[model samples]
Target: MIKNLVHHKDNIVTISETMNCLDAIEILEQHSLRNAPVVDATNTLYRGNIYRYHIYKYKFHHPDADLAQVKVTQFLKNTTRVVHENDSFYQLIFAIRDLPFIAVLDKENVFTGVIQHDVMINYLAQAWVADKSGYVLAIQTRGEKGELNKLARLVNRKADIQSAVTFEKTTYDTSTYLMVTLPEYLDVSSVRALVNDLTRRKYDVNVVTL
Candidate 1:
């Protein structure tokens, strides 16, 4: 799977307790961000998450009021939570819904880094592409060691098949399924004939396209 835990930069959205509602809005707009974390001036303690929706609601009702005059601490949700660097990807997905970020902290609660959603998405996509298409093959063999290697060597010798791979399925016992990419065109009957030959030799072979 994905190995880059610090795939996203650690500069999480943060604001000072002295910041007002207007200041929070400005930070969100400048970064194109929807939310930010409020922190103390010393940066030692997390305050809470400031959401765009709450700011808009406040502005609608108090049209003439000065947002800068209102302290962010007044609106703080007061439920600060964080995630560790060693947390799993599955845990991160759930944490993002409520936290939008997982503040990396030391044992003394010192901020070390941050993880964002965009970076996580990029890392996961790269991992999926690598796992799915790394191997290609075509063969007719029983589910046994050395059988796949023998088919690969045969295809490589003939120069007709460029690459080959085998997939195995086990219900009560294991069976081999083969897939191969070939350069020359072969008709359906010719393919069936090859499969029949493999069956005569006690191989359960299924041809799959790549």
Candidate 2:
């Protein structure tokens, strides 16, 4: 999964402690970044993050103020930021949607970097495309292994299917389930044939779309 590739990469923008509000705004415009992390001299920990909207609004309201005199810290967003590394693409999508950009924090809450919404979305889309395999939810069975293999083989014979798998075991009975994805759509008769074949073999099969 793309979650494994998520890490504190150096691609993230950073602002120095000495940077003024104008400097931070200029940097944000230059890099096309909405938010950036503020770091001290050693660049060990992040003090806060500055959003472009804050700077723009301040400039609009206080047009006559000296830009150099305004401190970047004064305009920083003081709220706690959500961050995650190695989180699944599914989780990352919701996180990015909920938060502006998740600050990639280390064990000590030290800022490592940030994951932008666009970047994370692209990663998730790619992962979805890669995981083209089909999934099935089945009831547990006594001889599930052999039955699943045979069912998979039957499906593959009619279509260009790949990577069949099962999910979400229910404990009501010994029934097994499998999920398969085909390169193309299967006709209703083909699906019915599969159900009939499983029934004849004394295996209770339920096919579901995922």
Highest lDDT, which number?
2
* Candidate 2 segments exceeding 4 Å error: 1-9, 86-91, 98-100, 130-210
- TM for candidate 1 is 0.54
| lDDT over C-alpha atoms for residue 164 of model 1 | 48
- Candidate 1 — which pairs collide? 10-114, 137-164, 137-165, 137-179, 137-180, 138-164, 138-165, 138-179, 138-180
- Report lDDT (Cα) of residue 79, candidate 2: 39
Candidate 1 at 9: error in angstroms? 8.0
Q: List, residue by residue over 14-96, the lDDT tens digit for candidate 2.
A: 88777898888889999998878787777766677788898888888989987788888887664365554555666666656
